[model samples]
Target chain A: MSPESEEMMWCHSCREEYDALDAGTCKECYEEASETEEELKREIEDLKSKVHFLRLSSPIESDLSPSDVSLHASSDRKGVYPPVPAHKIVLMSRSPVFRAMLGGEMEESRSGVIKIEDVSYNVLCSFVQYMYTADTLLNEQLACELLILAEKYQVKHLKFFCERFMTSRISNDNAVTNFAFAHRYNSKNLLESSLALILDNISTLTQREDYKDLVEKDPRLVVEIYEAYLSRQVNTAASVKELQNV
Target chain B: MSPESEEMMWCHSCREEYDALDAGTCKECYEEASETEEELKREIEDLKSKVHFLRLSSPIESDLSPSDVSLHASSDRKGVYPPVPAHKIVLMSRSPVFRAMLGGEMEESRSGVIKIEDVSYNVLCSFVQYMYTADTLLNEQLACELLILAEKYQVKHLKFFCERFMTSRISNDNAVTNFAFAHRYNSKNLLESSLALILDNISTLTQREDYKDLVEKDPRLVVEIYEAYLSRQVNTAASVKELQNV
Candidate 1:
């Protein structure tokens, strides 16, 4: 055989000729990997169908006959918006706060009217929809609002969902604000990531308007940020000194 | 280098040496495949969480304040079983049969009691539990019983679940019985597999008691099985003749 032929091997996957040095796996492993991929795909299909089966029709979308309770987003300036209809069982099942309020002899339980203070009408609707379906289309503003509500209701799943969305959207502009919000909400993951980003850009931290506001509104949070920055600096200095000694 | 070394290739996955013929994929493809597998796993995790979030507390398990409807499994030999508590909204959302029966002027709608005939209490509880959680532990008997109720209620997900279980458990001893059950229930996948298994064991068909019962009770099904066997034989003979001519 020629040198080229000796050096070349056919790829089982892409079916192209690749050099010996670029070889991936033995044929046995390739076949086994293919089988594993197939099994994973089948499992994905099964889980997808299970999700479809478990998803309840959002009460907001469907004309479900019995919505036992109604929720209003209380607004001081605009008065009360129309009630967002919901099932008590659904609310109770999803949130411990709702369960306590509805399961006990609370005013909300007796009147079948839940007054959710300081939430917008649209946000309230989305919240109720999520209770039924465990899904919602979210932007940054909506995610933050819903995160607060989820936190109050003790809906851990929705709170985590919102935190994930907000964390993904974090940037230099929002890192300080998000860090403060994360701290307030006990969002450890969001707090850590935002603090890391803030520390990375520590030179310009004092110049931003949000930074000044954070120092005024929550001076303790500002101190924590500085403490983290100082700790990182000490660790870096220690590493450099140890390297020099070596 | 030795000839042995010259003829060998390394598997990136298992880190083992093998011949050129045993080669699987190139390095690039292997890395890409690994990444793809990781992505698939992450997707599975996300989907599993979604399933968990969507799963509702079965009314049977929880002392939920309001259960709008109750179910009784009517048995001929035994007296009526205790009521299985459920929410109307859950029943309506899961099955169209329940939607029509409860949504309209049906007797079940007026009384808030649904009488499920020809089902045992254990099976009834399992059926309602699956309605809420989309899960159940099934033996062969339970699978068969739930499948019938699932079929009656037009709960396609549960029906498919039962069909998959029964299909996995099909054997020579039970093939004829399952074929009849699958046929009666319009289970195409189960019917096809059971029919194929029967055709594979055509010579022993008359020896089985279930086969004799099937011949006595549903002669048409027996005739259909024989027809399928003859069709397979003709196709086999045709393929043999083609090979001989070649």
Candidate 2:
């Protein structure tokens, strides 16, 4: 309850939400989450060490080409490949205690020669880094970059951050609306957070000039919010009428 | 490219499609875009000054009850009126940006008072602001909120943001895969952008984990991207296999 207390914590596995409570993993999925964390951490650390060693190797062999490492060709050697991305960054970043056990600096272990020209590769690296660490102060610019990276690699953790980072910045109305679009397909937990914001501010949100633009893109949000307040079964015709007034 | 170059503007309105150049609102829509921007700016500014002059006295005067404002009579005034949330910081901080454009704070506005808690009010206010302004940031958040809010109020922008922002984030492989979905759903420009991303980065993105996610979300993206590359030839099955191999 202190002002200096940490903000934002929760286990996606259990969907039990909390902000800054530190018992470490949620009680329900603690072992499963912990086991997964350890395995992935080991893998990430191993990967990072390889990458760092690769980078530290003098003359940084810039020779590896995308054309050379053809995934279609069975014989395309995997030794000097591009960077990797994963879905468990935010999940991994959840427990500082867990991360410390894994041996830090995950990006330091990667063992490939992924080109920066390949945006996907860079995104993967970023996700790996994000896995080991994340903080409020990380650059918004980097956050934006990592989001694109997350989406590119299909890294759910990075993608989650894309959503979470954006959510944390919801100090203004514009951000709320924009995020609504960005994380549209985000599964249940994220959807609920967004709903809380919109449902609670109906009158104010409804009256804005560009509100029509929002409506045009998605009339469903209006319908849903209307549904929230309607404790009684809403006749479709009357529902539409009430919505018109609301 | 020079970092000082102002010419390299990343116009969201224009560069809609991944490979396709920026072109969301057409050149013709420029007049409207400019007009809307100016009008919104002026309106918001005017409103802020008005609220400042009006100064509705109490930070927490008699709570504005949503039920009292409604035409329908209610016995349970408290049931109709939800207690305000503690984080309701909107009117208090008095964001100059909000004060200027929103005409009046939520309670002070024409709809009379609907007692939403502060954080919710701020969130809703942002959504409304986003709808009118087409502010990218707000829209993004609103898109996420729409799923929740849309289920309640029949608000369109929230849903619009949720869907459109996701579509708008399209670029490279993500766009390529997404456009394939967009094309399936009849999202024209979105399809265009997705195709562009795929077309441009098919070599790599086709091999991304999202490629698999896209396929899972809709096999159409896989087929359509194929069709896009090999238009109308109907050799999509072979191309799909090739992509699978990639």
Candidate 3:
């Protein structure tokens, strides 16, 4: 409309006029970036199709394949649950624990029935389904339970999946509990994030019941938290001192 | 640097100074594009891990799983090649043809051996390997052979893979042959690309030996090519007349 407005450059992306101060990349860079984005999107589509093609129909969802092995989740209060049918090849392929257990001359391999301790029937079903599809719907509780099972059976991908889910769901409310769980399962990512969250809210740490319970159950873990907090405090103080010196 | 040079804007990406005419995007659009690129990259990484998790070791490559089925590729010159061992569930999952044959009371299902006629041993092995892993290395000749097997078995993913490979290798020399092969296999992508290449070099079409052979073997295919070329010519002439009127 105006001479000044006409002189303002328009963004090729958003098509909005902006001053030189608000400039981003040049035309060549912009074209290169756009091409890179398109190439990345194409790669994503190709990989997604490959995942779809490789994914097998879960045996629990279908009875097409005669399952050679069945998993029983042993429950103390409710008695034995119904067996979760799975293929030995699938289980072995997914987990080295299962591979060793099923591939060797073990009694469970001979019987073709595996008795898993301390996991619920629902959790076991989801676990087996993940082995087939590399996918699962996860709430916080399921994430925690599956992480434990994943850690025990050495399913690194599932363990990483659960850890990422748990990390996303981390809050001040469950920071202490998640910290303990992460430590137990050797989830480095979860441990770092949960510890960071706990230290960020260190003043209210002792007031929480879970924090107090963790203090009583595992005083060493509580001490580790304090050590991290103290180390952070020292680093901040030293940085401030250096700033004043400069 | 001169005062005028100092007044020039620098790209955030390449850090090169550019004038108003060379401007790309505003700061907001640039930041958003960067974030989108990062998200796409993260998604690609996630899908790649999922693919790795979902990929099963080919039974032909491993002795871990006791395969319940074997495939014999019947060759006229070499006689019957060694049976390619594969899991029934894998075959059934990958191909509907295999599913129908294995799931029902077919002779192959009853006997646990499938006879694949008119395919070489190497091609059959690669086909079975692809069923397990959703991957195979392909040359032009192998891609053509595998496309035929993939078509017969109705393994759409493998067929698509081979078609994509063949399409990439399409040249003026092979366009006629590939066009016919694509038509026979109902490979729309390969057919379109090969036909485009053929039309681009239509002057030399009848001069090639393959073109002469195609005319003798399938005259209807040659007619279809001429039909496409004539349609394109008509569309061009109409556009030229419209431009002259304008």
Candidate No. with top DockQ: 3
lDDT of 3 by residue, A54-116 (tens): 888988888776888998888634766679998888888899999999899999889999998
| Stretches of candidate 1 exceeding 4 Å from the true structure | A1-6, A76-80, A241-246, B1-7, B76-80
lDDT of 1 by residue, A30-58 (tens): 99999999999999999999988887787
| Candidate 2 runs further than 4 Å off | A1-145, A148-152, A175-179, A229-246, B1-246
lDDT of 1 by residue, B1-246 (tens): 655566578899999987666778989999999999999998899889888888889988987658889998777346655789998889998999999999999999999999889888899999999998899999999999999999899999999999999999999999999999999988998999999999988778669999999999999999999888889999999999999999
Q: In candidate 2, residue B4 scores what lDDT?
A: 27
lDDT of each: 0.89, 0.42, 0.90
* Model 2 docking grade: incorrect
Quality of model 1 by C-alpha lDDT: 0.89
What i-RMS does every model get?
1.4, 32.6, 1.4
Candidate 2 residue lDDT tens string, A49-92: 32221121011122111111111111224535433422121222
Q: Best candidate per TM-score, number?
A: 3
Ranking by DockQ: 3, 1, 2
DockQ of all candidate complexes: 0.71, 0.01, 0.73
